[model samples]
Target: MLAVQHCNNSALHVDEGFSNQTQQVLGVAPVRCRENLNTTTNPTAAGLSMTLGIVSNIIALIILAKAYARLRKRSKATFLLFASSLVATDLAGHVIPGALVLRLYISGTAGGLCNQSDATCHFLGGSMVFFGLCPLFLGCVMAAERCMGVTRPLLHARMVCTAHTKIVLVMIWLLALSVALLPFFHLGTYIYQFPGTWCFINVLDNTSITDVIFVLLFSGLGLAALAVALVCNTISGVTLVIARLRKKKCHRRSAKSHDIEMVAQLVGIMVTSCICWSPLLIFGLMSVIRSYSGSMGDDLETYRTLMVMGVRLATWNQILDPWVYILLRRAVLKKIYRITTGRSDLKGSTFRRWEISSFQNSMKSVINRN
Candidate 1:
């Protein structure tokens, strides 16, 4: 989360230099148009989004930690740790960069709060990239872990020990950090976008090799991760369906429902993530390609609204991720619901007791449906 804001000064300086000339030539004030958009829509949307995101992410972290604590020794595995890491990253995203966005909403301009050389701008940009990419990379890792669990159960169990999980997590953060900090080191560049509410790598601003490389890394890696997640999830879902069909001949209904539910949940999560991110990924790639061919500037100016919309859509992914996890964990969610509604069995207990084997059983259930 700390690496997202490592923006370069080039785009910021250039945009500011051209602000007046651009308005005069185009007969439309670019900054004023953006300010109008922000004044009308940013406060309401940013307020709701940040408020909800912060609260939900905190709740998710608590619930997930509680669930992890309740798991019996037999249920403890690398997946729980990976899951916790993902949640923590999402929480940081909301707490750190999301807070900065709220501040920008209040300050109302990149000039005062996010000057080119401002530490606040750099921090926000770096954290945004770090948190955003952490999820994408971690999502891929989670898919691979699930795939191995389904296809090579024995090998997966033996290889993915606690130490290996920790190592993998450390590697993930290191890589995310390296990518996020590249702009600060001058390997690439970062800049505030048109609206001044956020900053990120200036992928659409130039045609340099550094820009293309970063753009490809950002969009390509994300798309690839989503693809892997989709494929792996589909394979696991099909395997579960086959198991269900085989068991149905023996008159087992319970496992059938569980299998169906698991498949639906996996498909739903993958689909939602794809829908939320696909537009930004597509437009980002298009921008890179067109910029390389010297045909991007006019198109970008013409479709600035669409580009901003893509960024807005991408922002929702981090917010929605934790909810997906919580919703999928039916038992945990039930416990939370009960507690919130004052109907919990252990009203004053510090921890809610859950069946230790539930999560383990959930993973192994596809193979143990009988």
Candidate 2:
């Protein structure tokens, strides 16, 4: 009986030690444990959200694959490749992290697993950062590619091949991965966030200078990418407009139409990204500045709630991105136009006149040269 009592005491001591370690590592107070547990009480909602994201991304991927197969022989294949990569990345973003969350929920531990396992927390946190930034980077790359193609067609055609684009995509992935891994190198740190559903870079009221810098770097890169995309898309759109106005008829109708389709898609992508991601990026900047300034004392909880909302908003970007390409195609738009306007042959009639004018101009030039 005495031996069993001693064994019970030892077990109790070990439990206390484990609890202390978890509290220290997670930087969560004992008072907040109940709150975190409560957050997971409705695992059905979280599971459903994850399920929707995963399924939407999977559907987008299938559509993109079909679209890519159709365009694989064209010069526009490069843009499709980029779009496909972005969708695939977003799919992974949803699947890997969603699986982890669901697993924790199923195990009935919810956030407890992350509180206990530093490796799991870091991996989840890094993935959040990595996936969050990759789409922004890829958007910027696509915008720049389209800008170059529109503004400097000769130069763009000479360069920017499929092999080079693949290399660029790999480089962008590495860049985002490097940023995500920075916390592991002591540049900053990841900690269990409020309600403890997942881990992310620490941006709480007690965030350190390094943490502030890390958050700033993330938001800054994302915002910069958006800004660059805006500028490039604007320039590409203007160039296309000017070219169309200056040359009412062109022999390269197919190429011109392709450029227009690409620019329209880029515009849709830029708008969707800005709408979905700006909230989180801006909130991140504000949180870090407020934390660094020591001015978030009374409003800490408010800011935390905002951060959670911002993250939810950002996640929608992945879901909406693929639809931009899927529905923004010229064929799709023309069909919609036909349905609404009751003019099935409007585009063909309009383009036929331009084609005849272009052929006449070609003949005139040839006859004058002769």
Candidate lDDT scores, in order, read 0.64, 0.76
lDDT score, residue 73, model 2? 50
Kindly provide the TM-score of model 2 when superposed on the true structure, using C-alpha atoms.
0.83
Model 2 per-residue lDDT at 95: 82
| Stretches > 4 Å off in candidate 1 | 1-44, 108-119, 250-266, 332-370
Q: Clashes per prediction?
A: 12, 0
Model 2, 325-359: lDDT tens per residue? 77887667767877887886764554444445545
Q: Name every residue pair that clashes in candidate 2.
A: none
**TM-scores of the candidates in the order shown:** 0.75, 0.83
**Across residues 1-370, which tens digit of lDDT does each residue of candidate 1 receive?**
2111212223344354477588679896444223312332235566677677777777778876776675523324455677678778877777777667666656755433232335666677688768767887777787777667766767987787777888988999998898888877776566665555566666555557887788788788788879998888888777766665876587543232323334444455567678767887777777767777787756765444555667677778777877887787656556687778777575443223223223446667556654
What's model 1's TM-score?
0.75
